[model samples]
Target: MRIFVLFVLALSFFGCSTKVPCNCKCPKCPKDESKVFVYNEPEITVYKEPQQLSKAQVYYKKQVSYVRKKAAPYWGEKAQVADKFNYVKYAKDFKARTIINFQNGVIRVETTDTANPLRTLKEVIASTLLNTQNPETVDLFSSRHTIHVGEPFLFNRVKDHDGEPIRWVWRANRYAQHLIDTGLKKDAIKTSTGVKKRYYVTFKMKQDNYSNSSELNYASIVKKQAKRFGLEPALIFALIETESHFNQFATSAIPAYGLMQVVPHSAGRDAWEFLTQRPGQPTRNYLFDARNNIEMGSAYVHILFNRYLSDVKNPENRELCVIAAYNTGSGNVLRSFHKNKDIAVSKINRLSPDALYKHLRQKLPYKETRDYIKKVTSAKKHYL
Candidate 1:
């Protein structure tokens, strides 16, 4: 018994004295008695510092100057240059710096302001060119200048109302003429004219007083359809702008047709069949019908909105997600959602739209998307 007890004690001592392996893997001990286990630190990845824009500012300035020279309209002696950079004037007084950069044969404008700088620049350039006697040359120069400088033009409107509730009829006519000469169509103006006189207008030699009359006429239809599907007029407008630029008969390179740019396959077999079943329409001619195209487009947008609603909490964010999904597939939007889940919901929601349009010349990805949001929002704010 004593011997057995002694053996048990010996076993306990041996168990207590023996070294146990750690939960983590340990380095192999050396053969020498003096050796001790040591752990190496984890390997870390080092990223190179990002290049600073200040270092390249001088080069950018020189390049801009060269472009401005090239954009000047040449007479026999010297090219005429506009004395004042309209955007620069606004920038000097405003909170943001509007930079127009022209690189790689693309015209891009960037600004820190909340306003849509690209659209503002487009309006500026269009107005300036329209005012010039030689519109073709001005358009060429403006396009080249925009591509070179990567700058956006500032938009400014002067008010002529003389503190009266009703303004003079001649004054209203003059204002209308100014708007027309500067390429600001009636649809673009927001101020109410007290005059009731009608005026004639022409675009590309086609006479039309109201360019967006059809869009306005379809507003009732859009509002009803949008309300039914829990959609916004702005979303409809954005899709319309992207798809057909408001042209009912516009066809894309992919052969998508009508105002909403609906391709048959994208609409699904069921949607295609339903769209083709409309009375008094040829079976193959469905794509040419504006009402059919808009219906399909709105339905598709609604479908996307519903799909993303599960992942996105905010209604506004869900709409943006739908917009992104409309541009990039739903799969891409989902992937982006996973990758940028921690980012602000607003930023994540705009990812696919930004990515798909990142390379567009007049439309800088984020800038254009933001502008689009603002424009649509503004239109809704005023009209809806």
Candidate 2:
């Protein structure tokens, strides 16, 4: 009874959905032919084919950068100084480009050397921080320079609009860094002439105009774009809502941008190329733009349905694959079918769409991916 009441509320909220033709069933394309989903699709404008790199290149670059970031000092970085470094004797010269440990406190001597020279006792300690496996040592070293303020300076407390005393708060959220799938990267990375894998220092987003209901034209835009690519508008809306709640300027912990949470370094690259007919590359400016974000995001779904999940025939099952592929990559979605390399199309065909859905629910290794699938499916009904 509760489920029925909720269904009624959802239908009233999003209105009735028009059934659209979907190509999700598991089947191989006929020999000497292509399975073109539509006949009258608009021609994609190719301003220029963007430059892209080999998957191996993208993977190597990402791994190197991750190694560098692990070595660098960032506030969020955590570490407990291993035994020897924590108790190292002070060298004779404290001013050299090495950290000097004394009975009183510690001081870091800065250097501009590009290459890591673990010559000093400090560098030995730094090596631990540089290793991706170790947690950050920022907390270990934060109190090294223990500066005791002799005097306390007091200021008048500030009040808020509600006549309450205001307090300041800060938070930290660890992002998934340098994906561990070496096997996936070499195949997943799609590079081109103008499209380069994007890198970001921070993933922060400011939403000054987010609350203005009048400012959103996302639904209409999503409807138009989805129809152009033969997708249900409600599904797109559900994805956007679940991804960023339709926030035009939303960003994720992975630093994925806009409503789709498209990560420029990965799937975002593929989606961009598909839409503009250009080499997929990273763009800080365009990624936040509402139109481009949705277009690329929708384009990704098209690729997944047509390419990765092509064998998945049922519309409902296809949608499930599309949703999972959006969150965890299409390759990972495929792997969920059978962890072994010998995943046959026949095996996929034998299972009902419901069986495939359950298989995904149970098989995906990541809790995040599993939760994402459920949320997107549940919210889809709301938009429908």
Candidate 3:
């Protein structure tokens, strides 16, 4: 970098005829010619807005921060343990948390309130151990969990790994001192370090991208479904605009069919059964029928609002999670809040919606899901 700067300085000096005399008598250096070189500096890139974070990025960061703190006392500059495993090695192991969860079924985060049970992860977790870094290499359980949320449990040496538990990481003991220092006790230990935050109205879900023009296609049916589902017509329109822009036959790489693009096998099947109480029904392709698509999509979103997001008390918080889950599955969305895979919604239901949103914000596993949440939620404002 210094060499490049020096080269630039040399060029500038030579370019400035008045600053220094041209000593070289070669034809390249013309004494009579007034050499004036205008230095048009390269454009500095500026990012206009903060982007919604992906699940991997969030968890990786959280895991790294956590590992750094816990591994510090052991792997500091002056320690014998640092010889065999440097801070780097220990840190990498902590990152293996996500992998740990899958290999050893997702552990419950335990303390006075949570559980720290150790069980072997499902087969799905180990199946993709060989190829997680490759984006093209899709893990079977990739659909069930984003690899970034990391493993559910921290480094539990006594149980899963053959090591001693980091004393500072003990929730029961650390939290007692933390309460004495702070004066008030916390409800549950934070998944990681730092003061727990409570975000209310101020927090917005991934901001939606506003479309210049709104859709008028199937306007009547959209309003009818929205009304039946007790949703704002604009909210439905926001999803429609984001999903297929009222394209009744729109399909996706996920084979999401029709206007609302409900995945045939998952939400679509459930929504279809919910809208129609019968067994025999075409799922994947027939969702192309505009009315069926709208009913199913709207019903699914409504179900999300009332069921999946029921733990979220605030209307807006519930709305944001619903919008995100519509793109990413609800299980994936819920799992993001706790490091443990089995955190029940009822446990944190009373907590403000913003807490969950912020906790799970950057923590959403998939980049597509994170961006989708932002765009749909941002678009929701315009609809409102």
Which candidate gets the maximum TM-score versus the true structure? 2
Model 2 root-mean-square deviation: 19.1
Alpha-carbon local distance difference test for all models: 0.35, 0.43, 0.42
In angstroms, give how far residue 1 of model 3 lies from its true place: 46
| Candidate 3 segments whose C-alpha is farther than 4 A from its true place | 1-214, 339-355
Candidate 1 vs candidate 3: the lDDT winner is 3
TM-score of 2: 0.46
Alpha carbon lDDT of residue 237, candidate 1? 65
Which order, best to worst by lDDT?
2, 3, 1
Per-candidate TM equals 0.36, 0.46, 0.42
Which ten-residue region of model 3 has the weakest summed lDDT?
41-50
Residues 1-384, candidate 1: write the lDDT tens digits: 000111111111011101222121113211222212221111000001112122233333454454344422211112222221111111211211222211111112222222453344333333322221121222221333222121111111112223221123344344435434554322221112222211112212111322244356357767776775567776786567554445444433232445565544333322443334332222213544455666767766665554223345556556655655454333333333343322434454455644433322233233434345444444444334
Q: Which candidate has the top score in lDDT?
A: 2
- Candidate 3 residues 116-171, lDDT tens each? 11111111122222212222222211123324323211222212122223223243
Between the candidate structures 1 and 2, which one is better when assessed by TM-score? Answer: 2
